[model samples]
Target chain A: MLEYIGKRIWQTLIVLFLVSIIVFVMVNVNGDPVQSLLPPDAEPWAVEELRTSLGLDKPLYVQYFMFVKNALQGDMGISYYQQTPALNLVLDRLPKTVELALAAILISIIIAIPAGAYAAVKPESPFSKFIMFGSLAGISLPTFLSGILLILIFAVTFSWLPSSGRGDAAQFLGMKSSLFTLDGWKHIIMPAATLGLYMVAMLIRLVRAGMMEVLKQDYISFAKAKGMPGRIIYIRHALKNTMIPVITVIGLQLGRLIGFSMITETIFAWPGMGKLILDSINRLDRPVIMSYILVVAVIFAFINLTVDLLYYFFDPRIELN
Target chain B: MQKEKILEVNNLKTYFYTREGVVKSVNGVSFEVNKGEILGIVGESGAGKSVTGFSLLRLIEEPGEIVSGEVKFKGQDLLKMSEKEMNKIRGNKISMIFQDPMTSLNPVLTVGRQITEVLIFHQNYSRKDARRRAVELLEMVGISSPEKRIDHYPSQLSGGMRQRVVIAIALASNPEILIADEPTTALDVTIQAQIIGLMKNLIDKFNTSMIIISHDLALISEIADKIMVMYAGDIIEYGDKGKLISEPAHPYTQGLIDSLPVLERDQKRLNQIKGLMPSPLDLPEGCKFKPRCDYAGDDCPEGTELFEVSKAHFATCRKAQFFSKKLMRGVG
Candidate 1:
């Protein structure tokens, strides 16, 4: 068991290492960070000092090695645009993104499983058809588009909740509690719902497909033959097996959720990493952008690790391995 | 007769609807299983044997509907029950076994967990009680080291072991009726023989009636007391297994028996039945079997009603009544 776990950890590190290389290369592709950091009348001496201080005057390979070393030590260097610690700036905005991703997953699972399982059980009942066909719309409509429609419906048209921003003047962690409280839920409701509902639709479809496959399995038939109740047969036997694959997709989706939340956050003007990344881009804050990107990637990697752990529960063979 | 019949299916019709048309899978089929008897249902694929088993359990969801029929279990009409009530009786009183043990048992669950899950729900046993009973079931099913195997997933066990787990789970609640739908079809020859023997011993011990549905004639011949030969959703022949195997009365039955490869039988080679069984949607006019029957004639096509050929034998063949003596040697 220890050897197996050790092997998995080794593979995980390899994957993360590969992700870091891709991220580094892609972030650099838009050209020099120095050009964007400077204003109209910078003196040669000022340019030299900035380059020297920022470590940009070093060889490219030297810069990359330095960046890796600093990143490992939890110091992501300074933001070229904001003139602050890139790590601190990114971490400040981290919680909001994490919160949104968590809420989205929670809501998606709650909606997807029952809808999918019920649809599978009845198969072609009018109710089943309603679920199966209705989910098609969920799958087809992009989440960003859904977010826009929701913004119109709840924020612009109704004007009932705050259109943008994480919260208002009320006291919560660094803000008013109502912004983070029962009432704050009202504010986050639209944006989170917009993002989450689309995921729910995808999840429902995946779950339904998994359930349809599991329902035909021999254990299910055995349940039916044994005079076990339909509800029991569905939940206890069929649904459990169905979760193994669905869990895999959900884990992969959690990583996707972070990627998707970036746009939705900026659209709603929520104080999350999405907006932070956009702000960093507009300011050409090289340190902050690279650091924020790294934070998001790390979160994605962490969620996947937890999901990998969950695999053992769904399938015991995984745990044994 | 009334007391003897634990389960009786009458004039049952089950049809599946596709874009092409309605396929009459099980049409006008009737039979009865007495208490504690192993009633074997034998047929080729697409003969609706599995569908019939599904119908009895009311496991057929949509795209397929019970067009008409009465499935009476213990004098209670199962077909008329609400889905809710039927759900109550499903796993408690009647249990089903399936072919391909690998596909049947849930791979994620341990054999212990799978068996205990049924007991916990249907038998109202506590988790501890269920677990205890699960070990007993494992041991009873001839699984060695069952105490440890109970914690192992279905993939860890051999085909025979998985089949045993499937059987153990089926008998978990002491279901009055066990439906084994080709339970040993996916198993090796030796494993199949072992499982069949295990099932026979368990049935006698529990005194539970069974409906063993399979297309393998030889397998059923070993255990079934009364065997029914099914074709195109209808039961074409019915009798004692010995009598049916030794002296089949219907042309379809004769065809099947002749097709079975026998050991050291010197008289004749194994005869292959001619023509494919027609698609259920485009079934032949006149007799459903007319296209494939060597004995078929103008009147033979018209003979649709089942005719008694012996004290305990019945057939839907006109030739059985007119020329019963001639076909007896071919089958016997």
Candidate 2:
């Protein structure tokens, strides 16, 4: 198992390296940051000085080599717009993004698993039909639309909670998190719901389909013949078997949730990396974009590895290698 | 000696309400099993042999149900009992081993857990006690190193060993009536013999009444005291194993026996029953086996009731009288 983990780590490093190269090339292809760095009315000499200092005047290959070299030493240059370390800027916003992503995932899992299992066990029931219908609506609505609709309902119509921005946060483990405060939770509810709604729908369908399949296996019938309680048969035998595929999709969806929470974050002004990356993209912030892409790539690799490891736990037939 | 009847069924009918039509899977089958007796129900695929076993336990699932039946176990009508009450009987007084051992045991769980769950649920044993009994059950089923093997998952075991684990789980509660549906069909030839031998030994050791369902006549004849031959949702013939194998009253039973390859007898081609079983949706007007029987005549299309050939032997065939006469001549 240790050897397998080591091999996976090596593969992850190679993936991150490729991602770094791609991010560098893509950002460079988007045109020079110097164009947007200085004002349009700025003198030619001022532009040249900025370009030379920013290493934009160097050859593409040279600049890429310098970027990789600096990145290895934990230096991703300074953000032209923010005048701060690009890696630090992304890292500072990391906790907020992770916090929101975790909240969204937790919400999805809490609602999806039991609901999906219930739907599968009683596919013809009225409640199950309602759940399926709700999931269909959830999946059909886009994140931005859902975010706006949530604001319109809970914030505008009823005035139940704050519509936008992360409310007052408490410092926990050196990270400012809204998770610890009730007001923070109220502020986060809409944004997290918007971000997680699609995932919940997808997961519910996945879990339902998987549970239905598992319920038909011979082991399930054998369990029934053994006079196991309906609860044990459904939860212990059927649900555990359903989890292998569910976990895989969950891991993949989590990566997507963290990476593509931009629209929801924008709608709610959740102060996460999504907004930062979006603003950076508009201003051609190369350092922030490069570092952010690399970070997201690392997260994807990490999640994939975790999913592989989870397979070993869910099924005895799956060898770690 | 008059044996004590452990289980009795009267006009049991299990049907599947499919999109096409209602499939009369087990159409009004009636039989009984005696204490410590091995009753073998044999037939080709889709002949309702498995459905008969499932119906006995009330394990029939959605799209299928025991529409009508009287299943009396220990003088109590099982069909009339509530599901909660039936749960007390299942896996305690009665248990079942399914076909395909590779799939019968949950791959994620240790074999010990599967065996122990029955003990825990039905026997009311504590976790530790159940684990101890589970190891013993595994050893009883001929698994070596029960201590270590108990913790191993079903995927880690061979096909024969997995089936043994399945047998262990079935016999965990020492059920009086064990219904095994095609238990060895998924096993290799050698493993099939071993599993059959183990089951026979275990049944005698525990004094368990067994209803072993299979399509193999030879396999069933080896362990069954009474043999039942089913064809397209009906019991075509049923009698003492010795008499039924020696003098089959129905043509289907004869065909089943004749199809078995003999070592000493030289035959270039094996005898096969003519025609597939008619689809349950589109059954014949009268006798279900008429199209498949070689002796099918002008009068064979009429609905034929079961005819008594002997004191306890019966066959649902128009030519049962002629077969009985032939059998008498052979005996005399």
How many clashing residue pairs appear in each of the predictions shown?
Answer: 19, 0
Residue A75 of candidate 2: its Cα lDDT? 98
Candidate of highest lDDT: 2
Q: What is the DockQ of each candidate?
A: 0.57, 0.83
**Model 2 chain B — which ten-residue stretch has the worst lDDT?**
B323-332
Give model 1's docking category.
medium
lDDT tens per residue, model 1, A206-253: 888889888866666666666666677788788988898788888888
Model 2 clashing-pair count: 0
How do all models score by TM-score? 0.88, 0.96
Candidate 2 similarity to native, TM-score: 0.96
- For each candidate in turn, the interface RMSD (Å) is 2.2, 0.8
* Cα lDDT tens digits for candidate 2, B145-216: 999999999889999999999889888888999999999999999999999999999999989999999999
